[model samples]
Structures are given as C-alpha cells and as structure tokens.
Target: MRSAIHEFPDDLFTNNERKSGAVLLHITATLYMFLALAITCDEYFVTSLEKICEKLDLSEDVAGATFMAAGSSAPELFASVIGVFITHGDVGVGTIVGSAVFNILCIIGVCGIFAGQVVVLTWWAVFRDSSYYTLSVVALIAFIYDEKIVWWESLVLVIMYAGYILVMKFNSSMQRFFMGKSSKNVANGNAATSSEMEDVKPSKAYSRGSVVMVDEMMNASPSKFRFPEAGLRVMVTSHFGPKTRLRMASRLIITERQKLVQAANGVETQVIDGKVEIENGTVPEDKPTEAEENDTISPFHIPRGVGSKIKWLISWPLLLLLFFTVPNCAKPRWEKYFMLSFILSTVWIAVFSYLMVWMVTIIGYTLGIPDVIMGITFLAAGTSVPDCIASLIVARQGLGDMAVSNTIGSNVFDILVGLGVPWAMQTMCVNYGSEVMINSRGLVYSVVLLLGSVALTVLGIHINKWQLDFKLGVYVIVLYAVFLCFSIMIEYNVFTFVNLPMCMEE
Candidate 1:
C-alpha cells in the first residue's frame, strides 16, 4: 500500500485536469489566497489583536508568546498533523522539521530587516526562552536518534513543552520582558532600555488575557492609539449623522466609576446609588456640549450572526443557550466587530493554508518535482506564511522582543507538538506495538542543521547583548541558503549520505 500523495501517474491527470482549465484555475486561486491572506492578516487580524492587547493591558511578549505565535503557527501544526495521517509520517516529519528550520532562519531574518535597526531583546528573557528552545532541540534529537517514534517519546516532547509554557506564563519578568509602566517612555513609541525605564514604579504583571487596565494606554502618545482607518471609513461614516448618536467612548480615556454631573447654583446635588442627582428648578441654563451630546452609544451596532460563524470564538460555557457577547462595543466600525473580524480572518487563514498546500502539491507534481523536496521547501514555506507576516508586523510595531520570541516560540511548537502529537497517536493507537516510520535521513540531517543554526543564533545574539542586528540577519539568511543548497544537492544524489543511499531522489 502507498499514499496517494507520494506518487501519481502523469496521464491520470490529462489535458483536462492539467491544461484544459483546472491548472490555471488552481493557480489563480492560490494567488488570490495569497492576496487574501495578506489583507486579512494585516487589516482585520492585526487591528483586532492590537485593540485587545491595549484594552486588556497584555504585554507584547505575553500576547505574542502564547496567542500571536500560536495563532500564526496554527497552519503549520494542522498541516503537519494531516500530513502525518495521509503520508504515513513522511510529510509530517519533513514539514515540522523543515518548518522549524525555515521559521528560525527566515522569519527572523526578514523581520530583522523590516525592523530597520538592531532588534533589541531582553537578555534574561532571551536567555531563558532560547535555552528552553535549545533544550527542546536537544530533546528532539535524542528522542528521534533511534530513527523511530514511540508513544513515550512523543509524550516527552509534549510534557517538556507544557513545562516551558507554564514557566513563561508564571515568570513575571518574561511576560513583560520589554514592557512595563515605564514602557510609556519608550522613544518614538518603541520599547525602552533598562536604563531608560528605571524610574517607573514596580507593577504587578497579570497572566490571563483578561481586562487589566485601560489607563496604561491612555498614558501612551496620541499616535499610539492611531489604528488603521482607511478600510472602515464607510462603516464609521454610516454610524455618524445628525440624528445618529455615535458615541466616542474610550476605555483608554474613561473610567468605569465615573459619574456625569450638571451642577447649578440653586440646586442641591446628592449622590444616589453613586450617581449624581440635582433636585431644583432654579438651575442655570447649561446646554449639552457638542462632545457630551455625541456620547450616547447604541446598544447593538451594525453586526449580525457572529456566534453562528464560530462558536469557539465566543468562549462562553454554552453560547447556544445564551446570547453571544461581542467582546467590545467601542463604535459601529471595524473595531466594533473585533471578535467577528478576528474569527473571519483566522478562518480565512485556515482556508488559504489548505488551498496553498494543495496548489503547491499539484504544481510541484505537474513539474515532476520530488515529493520530499516539495514538502520541505515549497510547502514548508507556504505553511510559514502566517509566522512571517505576524512576526514582521510585531517587529515593525517595535515589539522586537515579541517578534523575536515568536520565532523561537513557533519553532518550539513546530518541533515538539506539531510532530509529536501525531506520532504519539500513531504509535499508541494506530500501530499498537509497532514504531512509526520517520524520515530518518531527512530528520537526522535537519536536526544537525537545526542545532547548528540554533547555536549560531544563540551565540551571535548572546555576544551582541541580546540584540539581532542586520549583519546577524544576513548571516542567518546565508546559513539557511547554504542549508538549502546542500539539501537540494542531497536530493539529486550529489551530496551523499554515508549509509543512506536510498534517501536520494529515485
């Protein structure tokens, strides 16, 4: 028996499938998916995510390490999982290992350039996480050294990951590695140095992604609050008219305990249930100010069927039984439908991920490219789109620590959970007593290169006082280029493995 993905006859898909119209259609759709991925991630996903981070007072590392990194890396994880089942683990191993290598080398390389300067990272946080990442790589190499996967080996990877996640979550300094109350003083709205942020008072850093405080963002520069405005101009305009009461409320500016008051000389004001009440007819004539009159928010805005779209997006116990609560009602605009927009953007990423995978497979096959090469090169890069985009976005926003941490974080998940989970299930349940056949040749080579790249990155950043510079980025990209050339050569039997001749292309 063989997997459908591994081999296919050229004549099976004739001119009808290849030349008549299907090939062109798939190619066009892939390009469309790429465009859609860019727009949705940049516009909807970034906007809503930034809002939530600000409103909830989530530090960049906390957000990026757990959610942003995980969210962006989701496509890779899922693809690896499905590949495991379909290709009997060949595609999965290649994707996870290759994706980890690609993510570490390329995403950070690209972000380093986009970041425009030395991407400064916290020495302690970087040291801790990078060490953990190094540890995971070591664990992976040790576990897979036997060239077969077992249930316990998979468990080892997963447990190690869980422990690391907990450490990141509970470690106060790590969560707010480059962020704190003093982060308000960052130059031109970037993260501040230790010396620059020394004056601020020590503050408690919370872990859960719940509302912490809005006053933190209020202290930010005006431009800090400036969100993407072009896409939702019509939506914002539609909510504002002479008759419509489109409120301009800001959690960043307003307090929950505030009470509006209108006082007069002849009226006695009293606090009733913490609200001000003035009882007297002899009151001064004070009309509602333009700002005050424009402060009444609508109960429900211009949105429909959010929960129906994705129930998990609404994290309630029983969303079906109760009403779906929109995360925020800021205004009837893009930000208003933050949860909905986020869900839609995430769903689109998933849709585009599989489509991109399919497109890559068919196109590569049509060109007579080897499956192993395509899986490692084209498909691995395709699955990493979200990581590249998300990291670049965070880096450009000056959360360099978050951006860098995301690279390490994604690689950790890619190596451990992405491949480990599938291997565990296959060994424990599917095969019972048999070992899952890993791509030993590719895995061994990839692990060696991975360790080499990780060592280079760690030492380079370590010597630079935890900063990723342009030169370092160039070095990383160059190293990956070398790896790519060697890998391609290996595929063609030019770079020979001592004992694994069959690993070469057929």
Candidate 2:
C-alpha cells in the first residue's frame, strides 16, 4: 500500500493499480470534501448568526468571536462525531483531546517558531479570552471525571460559549478603545473608527441578503447563455471557473432576479429587473450546456449525509476485501497484513508531512506568517497536505485565503468548538450510565492540552502588540518538547501513582 501510494501514477496502466488508485482517490476526496462541507456549513451558520446579531443590535465582536471561533473548530467536531460511530468512542475521545493537544502544542508551537516574533497584546483581552478558555478547560476536566456527559453539562458548554460571546460584545468597547490607539500606529489605520462611523450613519444600510449575494458571487460564476423562454439554460462560460465567484454570481441571479445579458460586442451586462445594469466583461464560450450541467453537477454535488453513507458503505467492504484477500494474493504469510497496514499508514503520514513542510516554507517565506498567527498554522500544518492540494486545484488561481484560512481556521476549530462540544456531549452520555472509563492517562493528556492552551493564550496576550520576532520560535520549540515528554509519560506509564509489581521470570 505504501509503495503503491508513492508510485500511484505508475499504477495507471495496470488493472490493479487503477482499482487501487480509484479507491484511494475516491476515499481521500470524500474525506476532504466532507471536511470542506463542514467548514462551509460553519461559515453559513456564522453568517446567519451575524445577521441575527445585527438585527438585535448586538456587537459584531461578540458575534464574530463566538461564531468565528466555533466555525474555525468545525473539523474537530466532525472528526469526533465520526470517531464516535467508527471506533465506538475511544477514537472519538482520543481524537478530540489529541487534536486539542495538537492544536495548541504542535500547531501553535511550530507556527509560532516559524513566525519569528510574538506581538505585544493588551492584558485585558488576554485575561478575558484566556480566562474563558481556561474555564472551558476546567469544565471539560470536571465533566470527564464522571465518564459521561449529561444534558446539563452540554447546556453548560453552550452557556459558556454564550457567556464568552456576551463578554466579547459588551466589553468590546474597551477593546475598541485600545485598538483605536493601536491602529493609529499600525499601517492598517483605525478599523473601529471606520466601523463607528458606519454604525452611526443613518443611511448606511446593512443587508444580509446583499452580503449573501456577494459571498455567492465571489464563490461561483455567472452564466452567459440563459434559459431562452422555454429552452435549456446553457452556460457559455468555462464550467471550471472560480467556484466561489460562480456561486456568488448565481446567488445574485436568485436574489436580484438578474439575467446575464450579452451585448452585441463581448461585454456582458448583469440586467437586474431590466433596470439596474453592471458590466463584468464577456463570458467565455466553453460553459456547459443544460444536459452537461445536469450530468456533471449531480455527481459532484452529492449531499454530505448521502455521500458519507456511500463512502462508509464502500470503505467497509473494501477494507474487508483487502483483509480477506491480501494474504492469499500476496503469496506471503497472512500475519504480514498488520505490517502492511502499518507501512501504509506510515508512508501516507510521511509523504503527506513532507508536502506540508514544503508548503509551509513557501507560505512562511512569501507571507511571513503573522506573529499572532504562528500557533494557528500548527493546526494548519497537520492537515496541510490535503489543504495545499485542494487549494492548488480548486481556488488556487483566485481564493488563496481559502486555503490558508481553512487550514489555520480549521485548527482553531478542532481545539475549542470541536473538542469542547463533543467532550460535553460525552459527559452527557456518561451521566446517563454509559460504562465509559475516564482513564487517568487521558485526564493527564487533557490537562496538558488545557495548560498548553492557557500558556499560549497568555503568551499571545503578553505579546499582542509587538512585531514578529524570533524568540517565539525558541518558546514554541520548548513548548513542543514539553508536549513530547508528557505524551511519552502518558503512553508508557513511566511514573504512575501506583506501580505494578514486577512479574517473576517465566
């Protein structure tokens, strides 16, 4: 399997290679798509939330901090849910907690080092955010003790998130004040000042519909050929144009009753209710016909629930077949199957890791990974390989931020919202008399994750305002070293509270 993955392209000509490649590609793509969908859903949810917040005259900061944080941690939520089903609960718990540790120690630590220097932070924001984050960790630990999550525990988690949001909204005035001064020195100018003016301006209208339309247009493209009164709606542009841009344009068509009207020349006019018009140049000629669109779009746009079932259905059988047949087919002992699985997992991790390292270097060199965001990239880095490949293919020509944001954003998600929510749920289950055990090792790991998160939060607060420096790299390295030590201690039971007596030699 390992060799096959490395030499995948070579397998194209052979029957077995083709089958294996197809399976691998399909499985990998399915997982990536699932994660991407979750991320999109999170964004959608946040968008809806922002609209509600605006309607209630709530602070955007509260809305942003709460939803954006949760949005960023969505993948962890997904993986944990899947883990619950697949591994029955252990992997789910481990993945959530492990991912939290990964988020803080590995993801944040490595990124911080690479980022060079840490910025100075306002102690207030640091204390506030960190205190909430710390409290969350403590809550998680308290819940874990019972080995099951109760409804009340889940409610507590929700309430905690609500509280965090409230604090951000109500106390954001202080943040705005500090940010106002800080912004003057920074090149970006005063965002708060601009926002305040927009808030006070009576004619400054804010429309969720328009925002959604813009977002969709930015995601997808518009069609040149339209439904001619009764005929098929053919798209005369490239079907593979920017997806977000295309989606954005399509959204505009729905909301604004707009049509793509091509002038006698190459200019394309966005005719809205046959009144307002906007020119965005001519559409390309290679767009899909109605039939083509129907065929291609359906296969690609499989619903997440259906797609997940299909993937699992296919994966389980394929795995069973591999287990049953590999031994007979390989002319080797069946026991070697374990070896093969190990080799395959290792090879996949290695190849994936190398690709990630290269991409990170490119990003670091070109963009100089922001000091405040060094830790973010650590989460970004673990799944960096898939993200890099996806970004390169889908939004590479345009939405570069999608890739970076998705990667880093996903990492943050895995930690707070991802791990936190599920752990809360698990606690709920435990309260219902689930026979789950709260392993001491797991508790220790959780504590380590909590500590690391707090440390980083504190560090971020302490260095919120400073420019990027190199000492952060050393701190990250040290933090990671400590993480490794803790991991070894937990995994090996090196120095436990109770020592087992040595067994006599057989």
Candidate 3:
C-alpha cells in the first residue's frame, strides 16, 4: 500500500510541520508555467496538423478525429503509463478513464458553447464514428468487468482500433465516390463542402471582413498566458504558417472555374448572338476579400491584450512565430516533420505532466490528503490540458465535426491504444506476474457514465436534425458534474455498488 513518495517523513522538504504559503506559491507558479508552455506547444501542434491535413488532402473530420485526436490525447496516454509505473493508486486506469470522461463531457461541451451551435456536416459520419466508439467502450467494459486485464482482452482492444481505421477509410472512399457522381451532385457536394469551411465571415472579430479587430479593454491583458494572438493566428495561418496571400492566390485560381459553375447553374448565364455569355447584369460573383481569405476566422475568440506583444518582442517576434510554421521558411513540406513536431509536443506535454503530478502531490502531502484522491481529481484533470487546447482550436476553426470528432477520437485512443497496447505487452511478456487492481465500484459507474454520455451526444445530434447546440453542451457539463460528485462519494465510502458481482457468478 505504501509508495516511495508516501514514505517521505512529514516536513521532509521543509522544517515547518505545517502547510506554508511558499508551497502554495511554488505549486501555483509551476502550474501556470506549465499552462503557458502547454498552450504554446498546442498552438504549434494544431498549426502543424492543420497543414498536414491540408497537404494530404484528407477529410478534416476523420483525419482530425483519428490522427490528430490520438496525437493531442498523447499527454493523457503517457501520463497514464507513467502513473502506473510510479505505483500511484489506479493511476493508469483512472487517468485514462477520467480523461475520456472529461473529453466527452468537458471538451465537447466547451466547443458547443463556444460556437453557440456546432453543426455536423454529415450525420452519417457522426453515426459511423459513434458506432465504432461504442463498440470499443463496450469491449473494454467487458474486459475490465473481471477487475483485471488479460493479454487477450488487451489484444482485442488494439485490434478494434485497427478496425476503426479501416472503417474510417471505407467511409472516406465512399464520400469521394459520392462526390464523383452526377454533375448536379458534384455542384451540391461543393455547396456542402462550403459549410465545412471555417470562414472569416462569421466571426465578430473581423466584423464582416473589413473592420480591423480593436481592443475593447484599453490595455489588452498581456500575460504570456493570455495568448490571444495565438487564437487570431489560427485564422491567418495553417500548419505551414501565414496563408493569407496563398489563400488569395488559390482563390483567384479557382475563381474562373467557379464562374463556369455559376453559369451552368444559371446564376449569371446569358445567350446572345447564338453564344453563351456572362452578363454583369446580374451582379458578378463576389470573391473573398484579402482579410476574409485567411482561414482562421471563426465565430468564437479568446481576447488578448497588446501586452502579449511583450512576449512576442522579447523572445520570438510575432512575425518570427508566423515564419516558424511556414514550410519553405523552416522545414520542408514533409509529412515526417509535422508528425515529428506532434510527437515531440506530446513528449513535452508528458514531461510537464510530471511537474503537474509532483506539484499536486506536494500540495496533497502538505494538506494531509490521500494520493488516490489527488490522482483522480487533480492529476487526471491536469493531464487533459492538451485535449482542452486542441479541441478548442479545431472547434474555433469551424471544423465542428473535427472538434467533436477529436473528443471521440481522443477518448477512443486513450482507452484502446493507451491502455490496450501497454497492458497487452505487459501481460503477454511472460514470467512477471500481475495483479492490477481498480476501484470496482467506481470503475463500473465510470463505464456506465462514459457510455451514457456518448449515447446522449449522438441522440442529441439526431434529435436536433444533426446539429449540436448550447443546450446539449449544458446537459453534458451537468452530467459530468453529477458523475464527479458520485465518484467522489464512492471513493469516500459514502456510496458502494460494483459490476464485478455478475462476473463473479460467471
């Protein structure tokens, strides 16, 4: 029951036997520092992934959901692995399960509230993803119902993840096939695609693309932590960096083609002298303005003051930050680099996670609190910071599907690959025996809560004509809060019921 960390004598780190403001300050400062680093790395991560998605010509929703989702959730994954290694109470399983629950309920909920309404471009995609995710969760629950993980069960989860990829591939191929249907269908498809594009027009910051966004709070809160500029950059840049000029150029190239399509649709087509023509009579098609051409403009925004410029001024200038992602300016447009940056960022997140855990432990020790409680509440939540950042960026970019998908994607990756692969290797590797214990009562309820949240989200989209709105967001957040309360109670022995009984009889 004892861990090395727990063996340290009281006042080992300090002479005083009582909690001190110094400890509080150390914890507070470290957490914020970690937050700043995490937020910055997250900016670069999303930037790189967006470029990768664009270059590969992949569906933002599917790509973001699976690849980017797994990438962003990397922090929680590593944290869980390490948590178990450190012999923290149920750290591995608790973090993954808790993080999954947090993603579905908190991250998705936040995205919904931000957009006011997060619409699904294809409810079919939603259903398709939901089905696989539900399958994975059910399988995991079945495996863990025995209060232990076995080699075969872990293998099944890993296999299930591979299947998820195959299914996604099939779905993407079908979408492409449909796009290549009749000419009429092709035009319709383009129209549908436009809905998925995160345009600058909808956001209040640009104010219909002409108004320069001005600061409302005179001095602009400039804390390095308040990286408003980072959010703004999401509009003007991609993973490759500042694409304003490139987008305009690309738009010009597509303009002539768009004109022909308009003529086919009879929007401005005319016949004179036995020849077809475009008449300026019916106003010419309006092209996106220079400001609007930037991709990062979304309906939601995080405010920043000019003070952040101090951060830009001292270390790396804003322009330098812009150039950092530019493919030509820095690295070549290789998939490996984007992938590498993502991998490194996850590692960075993992390193910061140790800091977070250590700080939380110190705080708990000072307060004479239990390790299990701290692991579940503080450490579990801390490790999910990347998911919080990545999903918000995706959502703000108007890829509502990707934003929501990432939540599902992250949870799926967390449960299956995160827990699965590690356990698979551990259990299958011979002579080393194991007795991995989980809180039976809490584990059962967590699975139920997870399944219910996923089902409710899918049903809400179905009921609202495949649209996600603030009401659903509110519901999920409330659901998560209730679940948290029940979990705390169960942990404290105030409530008790577990799913192992059914397995016991079997």
Task: Give each prediction's root-mean-square deviation over alpha carbons.
Answer: 13.9, 16.8, 12.3
How well is each residue in 1-506 modelled by candidate 2, as lDDT tens digits?
A: 01112212322223344344443543354344334333333223333333344455533354445444443344445544433322233333444455455544444334333422232322433344455656776777776666555556656766776665566555535555554544321111112333332232111121222222222332234343232211101111111111222232232233222222223334454422321121231222222232222222232333234764576454444334333322211122322343443343333333333332222222222233311122122323333333333332212112222222223333333444655565555556544433334333344454555466557734652564422223543555566566656554544446564112222211
The candidate 1 region of ten consecutive residues with least summed lDDT is 238-247
RMSD of 2: 16.8
Q: Model 3, poorest ten-residue lDDT window?
A: 183-192
Report lDDT per candidate. Answer: 0.52, 0.37, 0.52
Model 3 C-alpha lDDT per residue in residues 148-201, reported as the tens digit of each score: 776778789888877765565465455446545221211001122222333412
Question: Worst ten-residue run, lDDT, model 2?
Answer: 229-238
Better of 1 and 3 by lDDT: 1
Model 3 lDDT at residue 331: 33
